[model samples]
Target: MNEYELKVFDEIEDWKRKITRRSGMMNRVSKKAQEKINEFIPEKVHELMTESIKGMVKATLFGSQLTTNRKQAIGLSLEERDELVRIKISSFQKTAIIEGAGTGAGGILLGLADFPLLLTIKMKFLFEAAAIYGFDTKEYEERLFLLHVFQLAFSSDEIRRNTLAVIENWEQRKKELVEMDWRKFQQEYRDYIDFVKMLQLVPGIGAFVGAYANNNLLKTLGETAMNAYRLRILQKAQ
Candidate 1:
């Protein structure tokens, strides 16, 4: 490997270990507490939420012609392509922060609207990032890869590990993958963010919470997407 590629390889190896590490006691405790809170909500409410998020995600996947059509770059080193991706992530982060604050300050109605808006922003960023990394998001397998990257960012420790394995072995494993369960996808993402996002509906502090939460979420997704693509590209380098 070249110097730059070696550095990225080391970084990605560290990230791989971090994502698959066992959850600490505090993480387990927090997850249980969140589960308890989720139990109070009705099953019907949960179903409706899953459906809503699924619809938004499906719309973004099939309807939006935003980033999926971008021709993958050529004649750039991995380092140069990653620089372009970092710029894209930064732009999307700012857009997410603005959307979060606006919806949050507008009270419950607009706060509710934040879900679909933020999902779209994140997916669009992924598509653009994939293109920058030389992956064509219009292809089914590439889009599936993006979803696994998303799950890796927002799932529990065990699920995260499993998803990472899928991403790591995508070329071999994808033939076995028929379809992603949208309901499970929706549920996992929602469970991951339910508490903080709920605070975005509060009367007084919603704007601050929303902005902070959304900003951080985008950052997490950006990091995950970068590392996920690195796994593939660096493997090819080997």
Candidate 2:
């Protein structure tokens, strides 16, 4: 690896340590509280949320395939690919900010609309990032890898660790996995973002909160995707 690649490798190592570390007290407490809250939410509501997210995600997966550039980038150095991905991430972040602000300004009805819209934006960005990194999103396993990347970004610490393991050994692991656990996927994703997203439904400051939250969310996902791909590329070189 060159100097830039070595720096990225160091960043990936640090990210791995941070992600796999145990959650702090406040995070654990918050997670427990969220679980308790989930118990009281009627099963029907849970089912509705699960199905809604599942449907939207599945739709986005297929839809993004049709729209994303199928050809992987060729002959680019890791530095060049990373630069392109950073540009793509910035573009998607701006799009998410605009969508969040617009929907949030409209209050409850539009706030509700933001859920599916943001999901679409995030998934589309992942697809594009895959192409930039020279990964083929057309393959089912690669698409599934994108979903693992998503989970690693938004899930609780425990789930994040497990997902990271899958990502780390994806070439071997992908052979054993046939499908995703949609139920677990939706629940973890929903729980992770529910609080901030709920704040985006408030009447007065919804727009600002929505924009800020979406910006941070995209930033997190972008970082996670970049490192995840970097790990794969660097590991293969080894």
Candidate 3:
């Protein structure tokens, strides 16, 4: 590997180590508390949450209609493509911040609206990222790759490791892979953002919390997408 690629590989190792590390005591406690809360809730409430998450997951997985909308940057080097992606990520981050601010300002009602809206923004950004990286989103497998990238961005450590393994060996694993578990996807995603997103529902400081949280979340996704594609690209070069 060249110097830059070597550097990226090292960074990927660091990221993996960080993400796969055991959760701290506080995090474990928080997770346990949430689990307990869920247990206490009526089955009907659980059913409603399942339905809601299912709807979000369906909207995400079943429809990637934006594939054609992401203009491809043909004839670019990986470095050039990623520079353009940086620009795209910046633009999308601004859009997310605006959406978060607007929703947060509307208090409880619009805070609720933020879920689906943010999901749409994140998916669109991923589609555009894939296209910029010279991956065709029109293909089903490539779209499935995007879902794995999303999961890697938002899943728990154990789930993230499993997702990363699939990503790292997607060519081989995809032969055996079917659809992802929608319930697991929804649970991990909700759990990953539960605390900060809860703050976005607060009446007084919701706007600020929403904007900050959305900005950070997009940053995380952008980094994950960039590195995931980098691994693929570099692996192919080898």
Candidate 4:
């Protein structure tokens, strides 16, 4: 491996360890609290939420593909691709921040709208990242991989560990997997972001909270996406 590739390999190793690490006391307590709250919610409510998120995500996936540049980067080294992806991440982050501030300023109605808007921004960035990495997002398995990457960024510690394993072995694992578990996907994602996002609905501080939360969220997603594609590329070299 070149020096840049080796440096990235080490970074990926550190990221792998960090992601699969055990959760702290606060995380455990928070997860349990969320679970208790979830139990009190009606089953129908859960079903409705799952279906809503599923539809929203499916629509975003379709729309992102329509808008994403179809041309895959070719004849580029890992460093070159990484440079392009960093630029894309910065652009998307700015977009997310603006959208968050706008929706958040509009109160509850617009705060609610931030969910889908932010989701679309994240997915579009993932598609761009995939293309930069020379992966064709139009391919079914590639899109599915992006979903796993999304889950990895937002899930609880246990789910994150399991999802990382799937991503790590995706070349072989994709053959065995038919489709994602939409219920689990939606629940985990919602649970992960619920607290901070809820703060975005508060009338007084909603706009500030929304912009700050979205900026950090997009940053997390960008780091996760980069390391994920790095893992795949470096592993293939091995």
lDDT of all predictions: 0.86, 0.91, 0.83, 0.91
Query: Model 4: per-residue lDDT, tens digit, 22-128?
Result: 88888778778889999999999999998999899999999999998767678888999999999999999999999988888889999888889999999999999
TM-score for predicted model 1 compared with the true structure: 0.91
The per-residue C-alpha lDDT of model 3 at residue 14 equals: 85
The TM-scores, one per candidate, come to: 0.91, 0.95, 0.89, 0.96
Tell me the lDDT of model 3 at 40: 88
lDDT digits (tens) for residues 1-238 of candidate 2: 8788899999999999988888888777777888898899998998898788788899999999899885656888899999989999999999999998998889999998999899999999999999988899878899999999999999998899899999999999999999888878998888888888899999889999999999999999999999999999998888
Give lDDT tens digits, candidate 3, residues 65-160: 544455678888777887888897898899999999999889889998999989988988888888888788777788778889999999766788
* Candidate 2 residue-pair clash tally: 0
The model with the greater lDDT, 1 or 2, is: 2
Q: What C-alpha RMSD separates each model from the true structure?
A: 2.0, 1.5, 2.2, 1.2
Number of the top TM-score candidate: 4
Enumerate clash totals for all models, in the order shown: 0, 0, 0, 0
In candidate 1, position 159 carries an lDDT of: 82
List residue ranges in candidate 1 displaced over 4 A: 23-27, 36-48, 66-69
Sort every candidate by TM-score, greatest first.
Answer: 4, 2, 1, 3
